[model samples]
Target: MKKMLYFFLLILVALGLAAGVGMWKVHRLADSPLLIRDETIFTLKPGTGRLALGEQLYNEKIINRPRVFQWLLKIEPGLSHFKAGTYRLTPDMSVRAMMTLLASGKEAQFPLRLVEGMRVSDWLEQLRAAPYIKHTLKDDSYRTLASALGLTGPEQVEGWFYPDTWLYTANTTDVALMKRAHQRMVKAVDAVWKDRMDNLPYKDQQQLVTMASIIEKETAVAGERDLVSSVFINRLRIGMRLQTDPTVIYGMGEHYRGNITRKDLETPTPYNTYVIDGLPPGAIAIPSPASLDAAAHPAKSNWLYFVADGKGGHTFSTNLNDHNKAVRSYIQVLKDKDAQ
Candidate 1:
């Protein structure tokens, strides 16, 4: 009876040792590196079971051992609780690390940049071309999209969306993204309008946005924005026509190629600042917040005209004669460059 008891005790010890080895092997497999050389994007779909995930990873060549991955999932409680979403995988990532990332629900985000000074049509094209965005707009018309967004005016959607790098995940709708951008723009406009400088020429918030858009298109230089705003504000104060060329280009619509002619400037359109007495009917492009602020508080200058200098900036003038001289100088600079 004592011998039988000793044999049973020895068997128990061997079984215990085997169990420890099995646990160590499973843990090592869990920490094994994934089979990849470069950064990769891994998408785990919803309703995918753990067993299926292991098999999928094996089939995609992201993992070498499907059985071990399945075993790891079964052994580790955290690995079994991963959610469905897109995840970025690096070559240095271990299988355990990948599982932890999915469990954390940190999905990859993509960026859509709505650049400043671009028209609504350009923004629409940008939206349609962006990957992983769900397109829901029935038609990309100004009036239709405006109605969809609950806006009630002709071309009301123009310049309503803010220009920024909007981040979104997979399957995010385009209209949803646009709504977020519009909300941000509304907040920015309201803030600028509330604290606007007193006695300005703007009749309403819309006019302010219109002026801001013009300011955005007038110059890309940071120092020139407020100065450009001053020129337009002074023009509006003196009942002078805001003969800006950007407005004329916007008025030309699809007819504008790479250049503008004197006839094009002479033609009358609602957006033609050369012909229109005051501000245009609506915004020409989406304006940056800096441009909006510049429009609200123009620089304290008597400047009435501006012409582009050769060095990516504008030369401001307070009189038509000085503006003509600046234009002549700009032309001479161009001629010199051509001669060179």
Candidate 2:
């Protein structure tokens, strides 16, 4: 009976050693790098289970040891609770690292770059074209989109949404992204308006945004923004008609066919600064932060006019005579270019 007891003890010892070695191998496999040459995107759908994940990884050749992966998950059940989303897997990532990333629920972020000075319609086209964004807006109309974004009291939705590179996860709704941009715009406008230089002609934040939008459309030059802002502010202070070409173009809308004619400029629209007094009804396009700052704190000058210098900037003048001279020079430059 003593000898029988010893034999059973020996069998139990062998089984314990075997189990320890198996567990060690499973851990080693988890630490090993995945079989990939480049970055791979792993999309795990909703309701995906650990067993299915292991099998798919093996089938896709991302992991060589499906059995070991399964063993690791079984041993550590916490690794099995990965969320459903698209994960970016790199060649240098180990099985354990990948599992940790999946479990952490850090999905890959896609960028949608919305440029400043573009109309809302232009941005809508980009939003619709961007991949992985869920289209939930009832229609592409400005009123519909504005209502969906919970925008109130704005007659027009042209410049309500801020323009920036917005990052989002897969299946994020369009309205959700737009809301983030709009909220950012609200905060930016409020911050700038609060600290704005006193005695500015702006009656409210809406008029401030309108001036900023005009500044954005007037100049792309970083140095020229404050100067452009001064011109419009001076005009507003003196009660002079803005007569800006961009406002005329915006007023024409789809009727504007590339270039504006004399008749088009004479035609009155709500946004036509030539016909409107003080400020326009609303913002014409999304304004950049720099433009907003320029509008809030214009350069201390008596400048009332600016015409594009044949170069990629504008020449500012305090009088209509100098402005007309600058405009003539600009016309001459265009004529020279045409002649060339």
Candidate 3:
């Protein structure tokens, strides 16, 4: 009986040693390099099962053996804590590290770069097509975003959201992202407002913004902004009509299919600077910081007229006669070149 009891104890000890060795092997496998070097992007859709995920990883060469990975999970039990989402896994990361990464559920962020001078409609189209962002703007997303941003009276949120690159998680809400963009614009406007030229003809910062929007639309060349601002400022100072073509186009409303016609300029509307004799009521489009600066600190010049020289730039003139002469010269030059 003593010998039998001693034999039973020895078997129990041997089994315990075997279990310990098995667990150690599993731990080493979990932390091995095989799980680290796979360069595949794993998108774990909602309701993906752990067993399926393990098998997929094995098939993708992320793991050498699916059975071993599954056995490790059963042994640890904590490996099932891994959550679902998009994960970019490196080829060389250990299985343990990958498990930890997924379990934490942290995702990589993609940047959304909203450039200055983009209209709201333009941005909306871009957002709809963005790969990292998931949104369906079929309903009141725009209106909801505008209202959340405290923008008033505009059916569309154009010219309101400030342009800047923003980083967001993959699952970020559209409204939240838009609100952040709008807040950035508001902060930018506030920061620049106090530094604006004092005692300008405009009543408030809003008017300055309105004028800046016009300047933004006029030209994209960096050096020409101040010159263009001077033309508009001179017109404002002398009480002459702005006579800007863009304002006319804006006034022509949604039916403006293409190009401004002579009749369109003559057709009076509130936004038609040729007839309105002052700044327009609101911004036509969002302006860049350079345009805002140009509007704030206009060049000290008597230039009141400008015309496109057809060389991707404009020629400036100080008076109507000079402007007409420049216009004729530009036209004649183009014609002469064309004739050659």
Better of 1 and 2 by lDDT: 1
Decreasing lDDT order of the candidates: 1, 2, 3
Candidate with better TM-score, 1 vs 2: 1
lDDT of each: 0.90, 0.89, 0.79
Candidate 3 accuracy as lDDT: 0.79
How many residue pairs clash in model 2? 0
Tens digit per residue, CA lDDT, model 1, 315-335 = 989878999999999999999
lDDT of 3 by residue, 1-340 (tens): 9999999999999999998887787888897976444475677777768789887887777787777787788887777788878776786778888888888898766678877766676777677766667663454454755665566756436566777778877767666788787777677777777787765678876777788889988998899998999899888888998998888877786869989878888888989998798898877777788888888888888899999887889999988898999899899889988999
Give candidate 3 misplaced runs (Cα > 4 Å): 1-41, 45-52, 55-64, 71-84, 90-97, 103-105, 132-145, 333-340
Model 2 residue pairs with clashes: none
Clashes of 1: 0
List, residue by residue over 1-340, the lDDT tens digit for candidate 2. Answer: 9999999999999999999999998999989999998998888899988889988889888999888788999998888889999988999999999999999999988899999999888888888999889999877788888788777744647776788999999899988998898888989999999999999998889999999999999999999899889888888888898888888888888888899888877888998887888788888889999999999999988889888889888788988899899999999999999999
Q: What ranking of all candidate models by TM-score puts the best one first?
A: 1, 2, 3
